[model samples]
Target: MRASLIQIAVDPDESVDSRRRRAAALVREQSGADLVVLPELWPTGAFAYDLFAAEAEPLVGGPTYEVMAEAAADAGVWLHAGSIVERGAGFDGPLYNTSLVFSPAGELTRTYRKIHRFGFDKGEAVMMAAGAELVTVPLPEATLGLATCYDLRFPELFRGLVDAGADVLVIPAGWPERRRAHWTLLARARAVENQSYVLAVGTAGTHADVRQAGHSIAVDPWGEVLAEAGSGEQVLTVDLDLTGLGVTREQFPALKDRVLGLAEPRR
Candidate 1:
């Protein structure tokens, strides 16, 4: 399956509407790709916590959703339109860092609200409500396990997706440049351990005084990096060999040997 990871550069000068239109155009450009993925919070820079409330849109029929749905239909591809700051319910209701997935027909297939909110006590942690459910989207080629930026650090979340029969992990992040190494390391680790394809897309350039880590990477089941972007806006496209995933798992069979429900370490 062919996939395109759009590493968008969230410029501070760009208006949210401009970025939304540009993102939709980019998605439309990937006409032949089976799947196209974008970075997290592309509308407003992820670290731009103050703008969250101003830019937050409804879960459905929002500007981002409307444009991206049309883009998916125009390109005839499955599009993971990254994430948006979702305003839940009525006035003063909770906000959510939500990821959206659209089918080729422009239908809203699945939505994954970011489970692991970023900031500990401030920023997103306090501003947004945590999502309780784990979401997986079933595609014609592969089943995708949805995760956001901070969620990548938690192995248990990925494991849960695997348990639910996810072979392709699609993580959209707005990771900072300071922790680029961890981003790459953790992405590879997730793919290697899960024996699945990892499509980790992140933002580029600077926003909210934080430079984004633009090394949007794709890792195969064997832990090999297939494609990676630089510290700028780029589209890293790769052809994923889904059939080889089963071969890698069959050869190593590490997943089958997992010992669950072990007793706590002798303390």
Candidate 2:
């Protein structure tokens, strides 16, 4: 399957409306790709926590959904439109950081509200309600495990995804430049450990005084980096063989030896 990762340059100065149009144009350019992925919270910068409430929209009828659905249909590709500030229905609490996936025919296929919010006590943790479910998108070519920026740091989540029969792990991040090494390292680790392809799409440029680490990467099941983008706005496209996951896992068989019940949750 061919995938295009769009590393967008998010600027605090640019309006959300302008960025939405720009992102749609970019998605429309990838006509032949099987999948098109965008970075986390590209409409508004992830670090721009103050704007989350003001910009939050409903899941189905939001502006982001409208633009991305059309773009996906036009490009004839499965589009992972990345995380959004979701203003949910009947939600008296904070909004959710939700990820949306669109089918080739411009239909909303699946949604994953970010389970792990980054900031411990402040920012998203305080501003948004955490999601409880693990989500995976089932496509004809491959089953994709959905994850967001901070979710990459947790390996157990990826493990659970693999248990659910996911062969490709899709992560959309807005990681900071200071911790870029962690971003790259963790991505490869996840790929190697899970024995699945890791498609991590991150953002470029600066927002909220934090420079984004834009090394959007694609790692094979063997932990080899297939493609890595620089710290700029560009599309990183790579053709992947989904069948490699089974081959690698069958040869290694390390995942079968995993020990369960090692750590217990606190009461």
Candidate 3:
């Protein structure tokens, strides 16, 4: 499939509507892409977590989502709208760092909340709810597992996604430039261990207090870097072989040789 990853610049100063417009234009320009993925919190800056509750929109009510859905429907391509500050019931809006997927037909197929929030040093991440489920949404072209930023740190989540028949892992992140090496290493590791394609998309530019290193990449199951982009506002495109993931798994059979099943507790 011809996939395009948008390494967008987080304009913390720009209104969400303005950024949405720019994103739509970028997608429209990538006419040949079958699927388009965006960076985490593209509408707003990740470090601007303080604005999340106020800037958040209901999953179904946001103009940001509507615009992307319309764009996907118009272009007849699938879209991973990356991460958005969404509002849920009771709390006014988006309760989690949620991502939404839209089909070519403009139908909302699946929604995945970030399973692991990146709260290692900063405690702001801990302010949000930890998503409990690993999304393995079935697309017409392939079955995709959805994850975001810090979730990349947890190999078990990707393993579970792969075990659940995921052919590709879609990860959107707002990774810092300080730990850029970790971003690349973790992404490649997931692809190697899971034996599936890993699409890691991150943002560039400063987000109020933090700045992200944009090195969006597409890694094959063999951990080969198919296509990579530097720290810039660019659309990194790559053609991925969905069948290769299946073929590799069949040829190696390593995934079947696992023995990490649950064990009885010692008495």
- Top-scoring candidate (TM-score): 1
For candidate 3, write residues 212-236 as lDDT tens digits.
8899999999999998889988888
Candidate with top lDDT is 1
* Cα lDDT of model 1 by residue, 46-161, tens digit: 99998999899998899999999999999999999999999999988799999999999999999999999988898999999999999999999999999999999999999999
Ranking by lDDT: 1, 2, 3
* Clash pairs for candidate 1: none
Per-residue lDDT tens digits for candidate 2, residues 1-267, read 999999999988899999999999999999989999999999999989889988998999889999999999999999999989999886554699999999999999999999999988998888889988889999999999999999999899999999998889999999999999999999999999999999999999987999999999999999999999999998999999877777888899999998877888799
Q: Is candidate 1 or 3 superior in lDDT?
A: 1
- Number of clashing pairs, model 2? 0
lDDT of 3 at 258: 90
Q: After superposition, how far is residue 232 of candidate 2 from its true place, in Å?
A: 0.6
Clashing pairs in 2: none
Model 3 global lDDT (CA atoms, 0 to 1): 0.86
2 or 3, which is superior by lDDT?
A: 2
Clashes of each: 0, 0, 5
What are the TM-scores, per candidate, against the unseen true structure? Answer: 0.99, 0.96, 0.94
Q: lDDT, candidate 3, residue 257?
A: 89
Q: Is candidate 1 or candidate 2 better by TM-score?
A: 1
